[model samples]
Target: MIAIRLRSSCGAALVGVLALATSGCGLSAELDRETNPERKPTPSETRAVLPPVSATPSPSVSVQPVSGCPSSGLRFEVGRVDGAMGLRAMTLSMTNCGEQPYELNGYPSVSVLDEAGAPIPGVRTAEGTDEVPVAPPGSAPEPFTLKPGETARAGLLWRMAAEDGTYLRVAPDKKRDFVNVRPEEPLDIGPENILGTTPWAPAS
Candidate 1:
């Protein structure tokens, strides 16, 4: 025969509660059910399965660096804007003659040329004004693209001094060779700087 004994205080109270459970208390049955709980579903319990994923290859793209335009295929054009207060406004335009696209930007190097094709001294470079807007206007330079037959522009500002010079020599920045240009319709750049240019931009 099995014999059970309870001591004083909490143990005795617990035994009294179990005696109530024998009289049909649900609390004891609920506790017993929780102690030996049913098993829950897990990932491996499901019969459905998904196959492993296969990676697909993506297409590749190659990028090319921009390059300066060749001087040989470029034709430069000068346009007259206005003349007031002794300052002349003009646009310097360059057209691409070749079949390929070329990249250029910033101010084109410029200098006054003498009768014998020599550069005149003492002519300094400065920023050109909007009276004759340059391509990619503003102080900074921007990358400009030119396709075949397309033109780019810069602003030209200078005073016409009979004693100064005859022709103008201009070239892409960092380029050794240059193009000789002469203003047909001269603007009376009276008291302004003797020479100036703006950063290059594509002509609209």
Candidate 2:
């Protein structure tokens, strides 16, 4: 009876030990699965997007008219300005280096134009009502006359409404031929040719 009881006790102890070992293996596997889970991308994966670049436009150049009287004859040159008001108020001048007297008629005409070459506002002369006539070299000088070896200067104050390109035309009177005047300076009446060849001053 004693031998039978001891064998029974040993059998119970072996069953308990196997049960404990099986439970410990199951807990270790569960812990490994909980600690290392499968990975997946989140919804905020937008770091690869890029922004676009923009380009700038080139600037346009403004042109004015100019005419000069050299000793031999008339020489013509064109001037180009970049600012806004250079087209509005201006001073037109001419140098007379000939032995005879020279006469200039009609005020310089101002015209404001759009990109299509159509006149933006209207074309007009910017001068006062005073008549400027020609006389002898030493006599009183005015806008229309330049004594021999004398320099004649005139002022033009123009009011304009322009968006882009505006220009001035310094033309001689249709009746008066600049070639007939002494030292025969070239006559310029085109757009974009009026500023430098002829010395100028700002309207005061």
How many residue pairs collide in each prediction? Answer: 3, 10
TM-score of 2: 0.32
Candidate 1 lDDT, 106-164, residue by residue in tens: 78877765545555555556654333322223456789788898988776665444443
Q: Which residue pairs collide in model 1, if any?
A: 86-189, 86-190, 88-189
Strongest candidate by TM-score: 1
| Model 1 lDDT, residue 102, Cα | 74
Give TM-scores for every candidate, taking all chains together and pairing residue i with residue i: 0.53, 0.32
Taking all chains together, the TM-score of candidate 1 against the true structure is 0.53
Find the candidate with the highest lDDT and give its number.
1
